[model samples]
Target: MTDVNSRPPSGTSMRPRNGAAKDAAPALQAVAEAERDRLIACAELLFFAYRDFTSDADKVLEQYGFGRAHHRVLHFVNRNPGLRVADLLHILQITKQSLARVLKQLIDEGFITQRSGREDRRQRLLFVTPKGTRLADKLASLQIRRIEHAIHAAGPGADDAAKRFLFAMIAPKDRDRVHALIRLPEALDTTEHLEQPQERT
Candidate 1:
């Protein structure tokens, strides 16, 4: 026979008794700290990796009296000819003043050209000149060799894993837009019908 007083109260929670909860607190905290440390290490590794990755191109850009901004402008304009000024601003996330300075330098140096949109005359389209294309290709080749070597060292599936990691690093709000941009067919292939070398108006 069960005595009603011996039973747990109807609303009482079945929980760790005696000092069990207190004993587990330290263990849980330790696990959280360890995970935080691991993430911090990964963040530091990214900083070091980016420094080395851009070093080679930085030297070449220095020779041309340019910098990372110039390299980025050249790269995107080369890849997506006819990219709009507003779109480039969004991609770079820089102030109009900053971009104006960079764009003026590239245009003056004969590396990049600007054109007006056929449909929207006010739209300023950007493209890399033949000189710009060569420079962009050269910079890309240096980075590609480094990436290829790293991927080979990382073994099979590294490329896919690396891409997934990079995509995940993008902001949650920007992920869908970035995914669309990367997945699009090469702009050159699709825009081949347009005259690529039109003089900037």
Candidate 2:
């Protein structure tokens, strides 16, 4: 009997995790069933991984009285300055009213700037101010450090592999979008992870 948990050995083709993707290779019904089981296990692990990851950022966000929405807005804006509000809505997939509440707070606080679009008078282009960038960078460093610590603890190849898994989970079109927000995996070399110094300015 094949182990439900172990992925089929390299020589064997993998079954569909959802039977939705074009590339799913469930050669037999039994293999397909096993693949579904494995998918559930992966989902369970992901739930915990995401929970832990967000918790790390949550602490930082709380210190500034900003919530996760603020963090997401700032993070994306910093990554791609002058992004449109519509693009942000598409990226976040949140309702306009919800996003408006969070964005209005950030704009009111001077963390982000929304300018009238030159191309489209009806559209608003967003940018993170220097202050916003600093805060976003600091918040981002928390996750970066967490990932860096895990990667360093696991060593180099593991980091690349983890990033590949994350990108693979995203839709192909969104893969390019995800790549824009993050480095091309080579960014792991910028600076070795160590105890980060506190900002003093």
Candidate 3:
């Protein structure tokens, strides 16, 4: 008599009980196809949105013989005065060599200045020059207008919904760090997480 636990012979196909395994293939395929469609839609929307969003800034930067890299460094430096190089690296997630090239151009053109850290002398803290501030503010205002128009078109409560969506889209591991970096106001910090209250338009 054959043992109840004996394995199936090699080269033989084994069917799962009740044909469940065979039935699951189509269901799994349908789910995968649906997910793929959703992802494709999201990816296309993001691509178009980013392309249009950066166009205005790109035009302005070209006039100054600068590129997006310069604009980014200038913008961050302007927003976070006394930004340390290390912190900038963390925020930008770029290599030191890439940052150095852009930073050198800005520094040489008098768009940015660096000074030793007050507490830690070895740390280089970055600040935007007056000229840099003007340019950065201009670039920001252009983007802000675009964002405002888009949010308004999206309808009431759209701004809050959009913010939630954007925050959720961030990588889980980096969300906490990003929240801390942005530093939402205390009154708006009702949640333990970084879901901020809607701004009074």
lDDT of each: 0.85, 0.81, 0.87
Superior by lDDT: candidate 1 or candidate 3: 3
Q: Estimate each model's TM-score.
A: 0.82, 0.69, 0.79
Model 3: residue 67 alpha-carbon error in angstroms? 1.5
Leading candidate by TM-score: 1
For 107-137, candidate 2 gives per-residue lDDT tens digits of 9999999999887889899999999999999
Per-residue lDDT tens digits for candidate 1, residues 16-99, read 775988899999999989998998999999999899999989999999999998898888888889999998898889999999
Instruction: Report the Cα lDDT for residue 109, model 3.
Output: 94
lDDT of 3 by residue, 76-144 (tens): 899899999999998888999999999999999999999998899999999999999999999999999
Which of candidates 1 and 2 reaches a greater TM-score? 1
What is candidate 3's local distance difference test score? 0.87
> In terms of TM-score, how similar is model 3 to the real structure?
0.79
RMSD list, candidates in order: 10.6, 14.6, 9.2
Clashing pairs in 1: none
